[model samples]
Target chain A: MTTQEDIRSTTADRHGFSEVGPDDTEAYVELQQSLAFTRLRSRSRRYLVSMAALFLAVFAGIVALMSWTSEPQGGSSVAGIDLTLVLAAGLLVLPCVVTVIHLVYTRRRLDPLAEIVRAQFERSRR
Target chain B: MIFSLIILLVVSRLGRARDTCSDFYVGDRTFTSRQNGLALFGTFTMMTSFVSLSDQIAWHGRRGVLLAAGFAVSWLVTLLLVAEPLRNTGRYTLGDALSLRMRARPVRMAAGTVTLVVSFLYMTIQLVAASNLLALLLGLDGAAARPLIILTIAGLTATTVYYTGMRGTTWTQIINAALLLTAVLVLAGALLVYYRFDVARLFGEAVGGATTSGRDLSGPAPTGHRSPQPLEMSSQVLTVMVGHAVLPYLFIRFLTVPGTRDVRRSVSWAIWLITPYYLLIVLIGFGAAALVRPGGLLASPDQHSPVVALLAVELGGVPMRMFVASVVFTTIVAVTAGLALVTAASFTRDIQLNLTDRRDGGERHEVSVARRAVVVICLLLAGVAILFVDANLTFLMSLDVTMAASSIFPALLFAWFWRRFNTVGALCCLYGGVAVTLALVTFSPAVSGDPLALFPGADFAYLPWRHVGLVSIPASFLLGYLGAVVSSERNDAKYAVMQVRALTGIGAAEAVTTSPALAAADGEPGAPRSRRWLPRQRRQH
Candidate 1:
């Protein structure tokens, strides 16, 4: 039986490609362990956690308010709509607003670190 | 209808595909962020957005808003977490990214089978929906008309995929998105004009109408509802969010761009487009609830609601209704074309080429196989659609989404971020997660013992919830972690290389041979390897 590795090697040889050499592997390990890569990973984890928390809090808030508060308090209304309903709808659109902000922030904050990692990879090629 | 059909044919023809796997699978990595973004928007906003969602809101106001919110937030989760790394890692399918770490045929086979299952389910739903709409439009009824419409749609979908491949599909989807957005905007504007441009008036009337019908506009659904329970609402939201991120058809769109930056741009464009689209959907849903009444155009008395079409008729007239219906028809066909293309690519690349160890030189045979696969898959989908023509297939769609969230989502999460994940863990996650989700759903209320169940006469519902993802998703993550730790196999060095490549996107967009060429630093010392292996250097070769 032909294993997948054998098949990959045969295909690689036929396509004039060499597998990753030890030198390249070493460089990859070094880059993976570097300070910039570490910082990037930490920052990514922070961003992921914060975004999840934000979404869950808003989503849970909407569900609780919608389920528990069946009738509006004091018969008050936001623009002739129930305050809870308006709040639910507004909360639903909040993530979209936050997404735009997050995208801009991600590009601003993360791009430089990504560039630093790229420069490190460049230096390793020497 | 005739005009829309002509436009679809022209759009598919404009794709002008080349006979290479790269061109067929990822559009030769040539699409700009704007083009791919529009295509992503089109691919995602399926029949649910156009027909079923508004219908839900017309009937069940609170639930509809939640579902729409789930969809909007899900795309953000995808953009922030999955899009950039997935674009940097995979070439053609989800299998490529997973196989990079596993290096096994079983892993690819499992991924391919899941992709086939998910896409097949989604495709059948779209076909059944479009045929139902077409049947209503032509005033055709009965079983014969349904099958005939299914066959017509299946034929058109296959033809589009055969001619356009990915490039044509993308072009077709871009047109579909533009047309859909315009139709929806016009409908919403018409509704607004009817309400004298008062957003508050629209909301007040919608609430009044729903309240008059004994349904609260700001509370939980009925306890005996066929949907998921109120307690499990958060899980349902999470399921949609996670499932949307890893949908096989939408997932493949990430790899159709040239680099990491384009991937980010593509998703950003999709975010801006999709956010506004969902907002309009909210307005349209409420408009349907406020304006439409019993025995209206939504009087099809079918499971799928042509609520948007009904609202159009009420707001504008017959001609506007036809225009909106045509746009929905085109949207369905475009989405089915995309699903068919993805399933074919998965079959050709993951199963036939990788699993069977096929060694065709130059991949010409692979392209041929993909084209053939499209016809076979569409035929099979048509048969399945006919079988479930009268059944309520929302359960199947829910199951499909759960399967995606439970299986692919966990596997990709672990493989990308977790360092100790190995071949065993991946296989276990793929096969085990799918099996658990299937078993749970089979025994859950979704399959039996409820009004909307596949077998309402049967009573074997061991689980109370309609969506099994609440349990299966967390179980999948745990299975992956335990599978990784239980086995002693580890590939730290390979993980290092993959991690580097995934983060920086150094050698992601090239043929396999070019990757090693970029790493060639052994012989020459005149210049740095990165400079020597730049695009200018590669072109000189």
Candidate 2:
């Protein structure tokens, strides 16, 4: 396993932002604390937390809906299927659709923020 | 028997010379999203889902539908909470991922302990179920035949894992998924045709038939002696959803995907495949309840025999039975192989490698150690399965899921998401959560006085709830929070790096090019002509 210092130095080299020499460990620490990195961290954290909250709310809502509704039994039929069966099918499919939408939306929204952070590191190097 | 032999041969042939740790562990991280998706689907729809869901649905009516629906929700949990971040960590095992920013040795040790415990318990269930089914099919019922059947199944599972590693296992899972989906689709189609594709009539007949046997289809079905309350039903759903989020085997699936994006896509694809499969499960359960008479066709109405009976009736003749049996057999082997591989991988990569300082022995040595670990772990699990052959399988499965939810889920969630989560907190969650879960389960009614208890004669009942997830899951999170708050040690910088990597996929492990053909096409400098599979550690760090 690499030391923490080695990891930091390696990351700096990859990002094209090793303004500080490898020997200047304190300067490297300062680089990680730069405003750009701080913003990157804060934005990503906010995104993840918000996504988590949204998913939890949706999941809880589904559970509550199931609990509140009367059990599907001997119900009216649509194309020979019971109403309850259709409801269960909808419940099963809803989360899956939500997950796909969430992933696509999050990827589109967050990738650019990651790029901005990377560009900032490069700008600092120049 | 012929089908089993053929599957074993195919899997064995595919296990050709995985010379590097990356190849053995993650298939050189070369699996595309679709391939990984299929494998994930295979692992997710284990024999438990294949056999138990239909059985539960047939027995409990709407409650079984809810149970199946709850399992579908688990994939959503995996996608929303676990998959992307876990892939971003870019570690081969959960232990490696958790220990990335925390104290390495202790955290790795604790993670490895949880992995082995969960894997062993889960694998034992698969093995015992397969052996029991095999014995029943062969008309063998004596105590003497049971161990022999277990040894045979375990030996086959171990051999597959020992030789194939991840690459072979991936292909095996793909094949299993295809076979399973085909069999299910055919049976489901037959059922639909039999009912003339009338959904209301199908369910109406199911409810009618089930009610004739003194079982309620409109509400929660009787479980042994007691009907499950709404709270207990909800708890089961919660336990399954949370339990799947931290299952060690599922974590390895994320490692197989190339990047966080592919990981997310892979899980989405898995859910797409699984949602329809479970809808079919609901259909099959209802079909079984309606078509197969309660006590006429099957010896016991509640057993999985109804599914076989349904297939026998719909498809007709002995060939149908053999075909359905083959599908079930393959499900068992594929799932058990995947389980054993994860257990062995964790044992080799996390516990053995981290505990010792001799980490310099190249990829070949590590792969060798992994193969040996696979054999050792399989043998140990088989021995334990032999001892508990008569134990209630359902209770054991509930215990396994509860353990994962109460112990592993909280620890992994905090380790990845919470900034203040430290080594002390990780260990506290691991040991404390597991200890409390085991103690509660031991005294709970499920194990103490229930007829399904491991020792039914002994009476030590105290706890009211059969499942401990309602309490243990919350208690675990609290314990982790308290431990982190009290700890004086802080590693903010390391945590910062972890957070960045996990969120941005920066400094994550890259896919190594293992195929010489691809490497040549890419025009790499001084690349080896022969097969050279090496870890991308330099780039990853």
Candidate 3:
């Protein structure tokens, strides 16, 4: 087991904190948070089920496309491949627009995760 | 310890090794959003997709690239949910999240092990690609493939880890990104010029004329390499293309950028970057399709693919040949660098954090261990590449992609979005998906049949008719989610809350400047030193 100093004490600063001392208390939080990223206790079944369902749904669609097309038989474009090229060429003028739109929608959902970390960090700092 | 390595590596590198270890591997938090966008553009030319997508287009007509488009969508998925959250939640490595959130050392170890193993397989593809290109260029016996690849690229990778570390890798990738763009434009432009600018007409002609055996071309076939049908998917094809393409090496590449927004932008830009490159590959494939007709073909056009041979005829000179060779070489090198760095970082960060996170005082050991871990991981990749250089590209990419799609992608997605996701679920789903897929692939009639059998009949199809992806991709996700539910009984709400905060970008990191030589717990634990590295205090909370 590592003793108190390796992690318990704050790491030395290169140009020593200009106007700051190593916050020993803040230092303790780092030790805890570092573990926070690495530890994996377990998961809830419901979540796993949901992920499975989503994977299945998308996969089934891929299969449906495969079977529905009925072999790589003809000179037909499967999976909307023809359309993909069309869209890709258009994006040359505007690379990030579509992805940006989707990212914004998801950002709201993810932003709250950050809030939780701040709240925990603040409380622990006390 | 990494900072020390960076100091040593500045010479061989084209750029400064000024970035911190995390910055070198994951990019400095300061990596511009624009650069991140370009970085994605450069790196996402995944190995699995290269041949599968190209062959699909050759056989299935233009719709083949739909698979490519499907794979590309993941980058967008990354931009929206994963880019910022993954960047925000952790400082280094996938193991960081596992250890930090669960406080489980074993879990971090398990994740790190998977990362290293998967990377080893993925890296082999790049090494083999380099070897093949060199063999083609040098006019050497194809049998010399393994030695050439090991001597050149392996030596480079080992030295990279020893010297430039992550900084060297990033700069190399950046240069490749630039060269790849120019190469793509050049080849695409040349093809378009030859076709008189009507790509659609060329496609229509290729599709209209495509035959089962694309054997009508004039070029000499490489000896001992012939299959009856051009469109056939042998068992080897299924394994390489589907399995190898989606592996973690590519997925992990996104983290090389500095920040979330940059990653987001990079993801978006990646689509633009790779889209044309692949689309141009179609033009190249169609050129082969057009030039190499059935019945008169000397070799299946896919083998020669006419990209290189045609360049000689079209440009009619040495400059063009050199350019073509350089472009192909760069593609291999760029990809190799990306794969090697991903492996190195995963080995370093994952093992370092796992050993130290549980123990309160393990920072220095963690750093030392991470460096040593990189050495071991790169060597392992070199060994695997040496053994498997002759395996068909289609088989290699298939196995790599399918496993990645089934396992790593699901884990990362759920880890980011699925709140209830737990380790048991992730493990079960990933292993189940991969196992079932591999078994089906084993009995794939096309692959199991003798290469020169008179009848070529199979006992049973075993696989569900076609592309094993249809089954395994979903199976993996199901197992992961279900595994989570089973493990939910050991619910750790506080841990979930912490994860949620991290994903939301509200997490804060205590700025660490330099680690002391030895801590106070030691006989003479040095007092904490200067703290110039801390970010200015802000009300982020």
Find the candidate with the highest lDDT and give its number. 1
Q: Who is ahead in DockQ, 1 or 3? A: 1
Best by TM-score: 1
* Model 1 per-residue lDDT tens digits across residues B1-541: 6744764556544544557788678766666678889999998887877788777777777777788888877887787778888887787888878777665477778889999988998888878778878777656887699898788778877887887687667766887899899988999998888898998778777777766666555455732466446657777778888998889999889988766777777887888887778778888988887787544523565667688877877877888877876777778778888899999999987887765546645567788899999999999999999998877887888888999999999999888888889878887788888899999999988899987789989999988888778899999998888988998767676677678777777557642222344234212222111221221112110
- Candidates 1 onward: DockQ, in order: 0.33, 0.28, 0.11
Badly placed stretches (over 4 Å) of model 3 are A1-97, A103-126, B1-24, B46-52, B142-146, B208-247, B291-318, B349-368, B445-447, B450-461, B508-541
Tens digits of per-residue lDDT for model 1, A32-80? 8999988987887898789778877877787777767666323668766
- Candidate number achieving the greatest DockQ relative to the actual structure: 1
The window of 10 residues in a row where model 3 chain A has the poorest summed lDDT is: A12-21
Rank order (by lDDT, best first): 1, 2, 3
Model 3 residue B80 lDDT? 42
Regions more than 4 Å wrong, model 2: A1-59, A65-68, A71-80, A118-126, B12-15, B138-145, B296-298, B301-315, B517-541
Clash count list over all predictions: 0, 4, 83
Candidate 2 structure quality by residue, lDDT tens digits, B1-541: 6756876767655545467777678876777788889999988897777777888887776777777877888887788778877887746887777776666778778888888998998998877776666565555788788798777767877787787688667776877889889878988888888878887788889888877877766565454565556677777878888897778888898888666777877888898899899999888888888887766434653343445445455555566666776777777777878888898888877788776665677678778888988888878877988997766676778888988898888887887778788889988898888888899889977886767676778889787777778888999899988998999756655565666657666556777656565544423243222222222222442
1 against 3, candidate with superior lDDT: 1
Instruction: List TM-scores of chain B, every candidate.
Output: 0.91, 0.92, 0.76
Ranking by TM-score: 1, 2, 3
Looking at model 1, the pairs that clash are none
Chain B TM-score of candidate number 1:
0.91
Residue B117 error for model 2, in Å? Answer: 0.8
